[model samples]
Target chain A: MKRKTDVAGEAQSEGGLAFHPLDQFQVQPLFGHGPIEWYTITNVTLWLALAAVAIIFVFVVGSSARKMIPTRLQSVGEVAYSFVHNMVEDVAGHDGAKYFPLIMTLFVFILFANMLGLLPGSFTPTTHIAVTAVLGFGVFLFVTLLGLYKHGLHFLGLFWMSDAPLVLRPIIAVIEVISYFVRPVSHSIRLAGNIMAGHAVMKVFAAFAPMILISGIGVLVTPVSILAITAIYALEVLVAFIQAYVFTILTCVYLKDALHPGH
Target chain B: MTTTTTTTEAAAEVAHETAKAGMPQLDFSTFPNQIFWLVVTLLVIYFVLSRIALPRIGGVLAQRAGAITSDLSAAEELKQKAIAAEKAYNDALVKARAEAAKIVAEAKTGIQQDLAVATAKADAEIAAKSAESEKAISEIRAGAVEAVKEVAQNTAKELVAALGGSDDAKAVAAAVSARLKG
Candidate 1:
């Protein structure tokens, strides 16, 4: 078993008073205490499964009736449906609507997972680079494959911009190809970093709350810490939804490029 | 100083272990599990959304659009019918007015013909009465002339007898006839 010396060092540095803010992100085996195997059901697995179940309940069970005059639950289902639908169609054009189901699934899963992480003691799967990398790379692979299948070798034209001057054309194409390859890295990191930062900041502020009882001047610091936690917590809620939206729209934009690869 | 060095070594050992257990997200060991579960979850969600939820919602939207389109077409048909009915009504009114004028003209001509026939019959009756009255007046004048002749003969015979002269009936007759002829 690995010893958590950094947590101990952090405790000693803070005079053995505060908990480590990043400890919440640690993945642990949910069952037997052992090293996490590939098949071991960790907290990440549990929370991701729960997010999937929540999505099913909201989209499947909520919309099962398919009422014309929608019930509240049905309205929620319809709103999410149209939101992703319009995004896919508008960004990707009419042909892009064919991939609505995939885009909708991605959006709802990330959205629910991010929101569930805000609950006390819940694991956020989106905070893991592994999970986000799969999603980002999945989109990257799917779009690239689709473009190749649809356009054949001509799909490489997406990297070649003819609008620029002849001398700058090759230079611009190199940059475009690099950026295209870097999309999955940036895409995964953006979501994971934003979520990890927000949660970490909140934990840091929460660590300051106990200082009020520990020191003479803690009274002044406690209110400020509490206020900061409250403010950042609110911001995290917005970030959670925004990050999901950003990921889904980027997927659509990538899909548009695949369908119509040009300058 | 020896004690401080030992304490520092102990802290370093603890920090090393802690670093090993650091951010689980960066830990390579858990990546496989996270990726596995993520794939499973995404596949399941995609299946539900594509096969179940999306189709149901799409059906409702299509039904709504169809309902609206049918209603609009029905309304358009009714509007055309109303316009046709209004045109028919206007056409009937114009035809009725023309028929009424024709009847009035026919009535006036019939009345004029009847008046002309009545005036002609009244003029014919007046002419016949005037002719009959003229014949009667001529008959009366002839009878008076004959009576005057006979009386003149008788008076001449009486005057001749009174003067002691023979009266000749045939001569008086012949003389009277000659005087009337002249």
Candidate 2:
């Protein structure tokens, strides 16, 4: 006795459409089997790949032409190289040279992936929570292992309230542990959610233009949609670069804490 | 009639309620499924690109930079050689001009000496000719006087011989010789 739309289509929530635009983030299992769960092929993946190739190509080619009198290409490459190199040195300290390769790689990969998602018809891989989570988890795992290896069980001092008053130690320790556990989740979700929300909203707004134009009821709607898309797109571009920087910088900070759990 | 109207109204209300109910719910779980595969795909890409493709590209870039530096150095050497050659050529040109000026000055000195000798010889010849002309004029006058004396003596001798008087001719010749000596 259900109507046609009810039987085959998405059920409209009393709140609105059954699928809030954000509902796309819900992680549903594909076949309900295997260690390798399936997810939708969103545009995020496409962007990440684009970003990776672009960054690699630009920097590699730019630096490849090493001249005593450097060309514009070489300068740009050196700037990126020096920036990341300095970041590692500052956070990881003088001994950070060892981690240069890893930090540099992370910066480049994240930056390129983020930028790649900005292009039309492309997906950003970093926009997926799974992908970001894996990356964050890897960093966490690496730094934690490094800390434990270097300091033995004393690395646990990173999470303990060692310097706090005796009475307040337990309370601070609980907070510290919880914060430590939230590291990967926050790192991954912060990036993926920000990018996904921006793109989804942009897509929804874009969908409105055609609807308004075809309906022919309002002239202002089309222009408004266009302006909104432009503004959001611009913002997304900034977000892409910032997020990459933040991710790499945070990784450096985590490494610093692992290497020296002083504070 | 009133009951019938009420029954129709009730049926209409039921239809409106069904219409307002909208569509059924979708299995909202599909999104996570999509995200999971996306991770796998991304991982595979990262491994293949980072491990394989990126290294090759990096190698090419390194080679290209080396090539550029070498080319620049080679060009610099060539430029230096050209500058050296230019300097050498200018020096040679200056030296050649100096040598040429020296030869011209030497030739001028030789010509001046020849001119001085020729002028002196011409002046000496001119003086000698003027002296010789003066001697020729003097000799012509003396020869004229001697011829006149001889003529006179021959006539006097012819008259004396005709008269048979050799003493008269000797006296006349002695008088003429004394006058010529004086």
Candidate 3:
């Protein structure tokens, strides 16, 4: 970090373009400055709570009316409800539908967190691997345990494709087993990487937004950078929703494997 | 949000005293905090959703679907009733038209019967009056013929007296009768 700061300072001296794109991702204390303990109420806590509140706003208050003829707010709740509902049913199949609330929690929580993080100067909980790993591995652990409990040793048949030639079956099983274990890692990283990259790039552009204050060349750089920022922000909104959706659907896919490992 | 300045100087100094640190996500010092809060958030979200929100929203959706279905059936029933009413109205209209035609036919038959009787009575009266007129004409002819006969007989007698012959009324009458007969 010190080296990064020195490099940024040198860039500032050279072209007046000092910016820390990754700085936005730093977890900080929301209230007071100190060493962060396990129970410390940091920005992650505040934002996580905000995400929960947003979930409540969309799920609880949005559906508080329960109107037969739904108002706009109720429609929002219903849309989110049906969207996740259909995704679960579609990907996880009928037997996996009982786990809908679990999937909904993940989708809504991640969705709200990602969206709120898009606000300027706000922290994104999902951008942290620690947070996403909890989500990804939570699904992973649940699915593995459920599979092992339900099918016992038969669950291992998921990796052993019997239809393959005897010569290739062992090789295929090894690959399948390894890939199966890698699901949570890829799942968590895919989301965090997409969000972090988009945000970091936006920060990079935003850092250039003040170029007009520095040099005459900023007349060109400032508007272009602002446009880039706008474009990336728009894309981030889409990415935020898509990542949540991706996470939820992947959870469903994994849930399907747990329920019926034969496929 | 705290920048790298505060993050690098203190948090990293306390937890991870690595000579070189790169990304904040990689900073293991904050992992415990993030993991702790994430667990809490997920737990809260899961409980709230499963207990309250999911069931409530699901119930409302199911209820709305039920309402729409029932409303459709009711609309279909009402349409069926409207169709039945129109059919009934058409049937009544047909019956009324038939009744009116029957009444018009009955009134026409009654008027025709009366006209037939009146025409027959007028014909009979005219026949009777014409027979009476014919009888009067026949009587006048008969009387005129008798008067002409008498006048002829009186002239015959006068003609005979002028010829200085005797007046034989019976012979003259007989001769006139014979001449008339011939």
Clash number for model 1? Answer: 4
- Measured by TM-score, the strongest candidate is 3
Extract clashing residue pairs from model 1. A4-B18, A5-B14, A5-B18, A6-B18
TM-score, model 1 to reference: 0.72
Quality of model 2 by C-alpha lDDT: 0.69
Q: Give candidate 3's error at residue B2 in angstroms.
A: 33
Candidate 2 wrong stretches, greater than 4 Å = A1-19, A26-125, A128-130, A147-186, A210-217, A249-263, B1-43, B133-182
In the range A38-85, model 1's lDDT, one tens digit per residue, is: 888989889988998898888889888877778898888888888999
lDDT (0 to 1) per candidate: 0.89, 0.69, 0.90
Q: Which has the better DockQ: candidate 1, or candidate 2?
A: 1
Ranking, DockQ, top scorer first? 3, 1, 2
Ranked by TM-score, the better of candidates 1 and 2 is: 1
**Candidate 3: RMSD over Cα atoms?**
4.8
Report the lDDT tens digits of candidate 2 across residue range A100-180.
667767777777766766776565666666567777898899888999998898888887777789999888888988998
Looking at chain B only, the TM-scores across the models are 0.47, 0.58, 0.72
Question: Between candidates 1 and 3, which one is better according to lDDT?
Answer: 3
Structural similarity of chain A in candidate 2, as TM-score: 0.82
- lDDT at A76, model 3: 86
Model 1, residue A103: displacement in angstroms? Answer: 1.1
Candidate 3 lDDT by residue in tens digits, A1-263: 56756776777684777677887888888788898899999999999999999888888898898888888888988899899999889988988889999999999998999999999999998999998998998899999999999999999999999889999999999999999999999999999999999999999898888989989989999999999999999999999999999999999999999999996
